[model samples]
Target: MSKSESAVLDTRESKELKTPTDLARKGVVEIAEELKHLLADTFVLYIKTKNFHWHMSGPHFRDYHLLLDEHADQIFEITDEIAERARKIGETTLHSIADIAHFQRLKDNSEAFVAPKDMLSELHSDNMQLVKFMRETHEITSKHNDVATTSLLENWIDQAERRAWFLFETLRAH
Candidate 1:
């Protein structure tokens, strides 16, 4: 990079972006931090869902595989919205995989062979946890009078609930 561009990048890193919002600076910071953690957890859950989808096997392999693929896609679709919400409020977000590892509350599965049933159960639990996290974040947004974020989170919470419901019903059917 050129010297001027490098200097600009350094300045940007050191300074908070000035977004014109009615929220107090402290409130904005708090909201951004909460969103960052939520984003990290979302990314972790998305990867785990994908992992299960790719590794799914058994007599019902096709159905389980497709279900997880849909779940993973749904989980991934919100990540960008979370990050962008943080940015819209004049705050920085997670910068790398290291940041995600640091802030993520959900655990990753690295086992070589997770059973299909186990995968469904684990993802169900994770989605439920995500709903809890989103609700907590919603409280913060509401406190800050961030209606936009709260609205977005409401949709996300519903989606997570649906994913959990699907997993639960699938488990019950087997």
Candidate 2:
């Protein structure tokens, strides 16, 4: 190669790669883009959970805060894996908080004094909504035979469902 061509190549992080799996490149790209949207929603949910965790108060402060903290950590764990999945499929992943905000379907709560029950109810609803999104994304992964992602999503779905379940029981009337 010529000197000019060599310098141009050096500027790149990595060369374009040929995906080794039988999965179609076009389909992988499509799936990864959708995953980006999922990642955004996940981020929003994580932040909301953490917000509730930090602001928790009243009689059940200890239990509620700990629950939210655990669930928030679980939600945060999914973000990096989803972003890496996008990269592994040769697609660009989300870059900034603005990018996540743009794609996130969940609402952010910045109020100073939401009731504990209200917080639980909101997070319960959001976790269930996430289960819906995860199921939809699973369809794409299943269609493309992305076994690794599909398997990981199964675990995530269960975690989200469990969070919703716990919150639902917590919010029940006597």
Clashing pairs in 2: none
Candidate 1 lDDT (Cα, whole model)?
A: 0.93
Candidate 1, superposed: residue stretches over 4 Å from native = 1-16
lDDT of each: 0.93, 0.88
Predictions: Cα RMSD each: 4.9, 4.1
| Candidate 1 residue lDDT tens string, 30-129 | 9999998999999999999999989999999999999999999999999999988988887889999999999999999999999899999999999999
Pick the TM-score winner: 1
Q: What is the lDDT of residue 31 in candidate 1?
A: 96
- List TM-scores for all candidates, in order: 0.91, 0.87
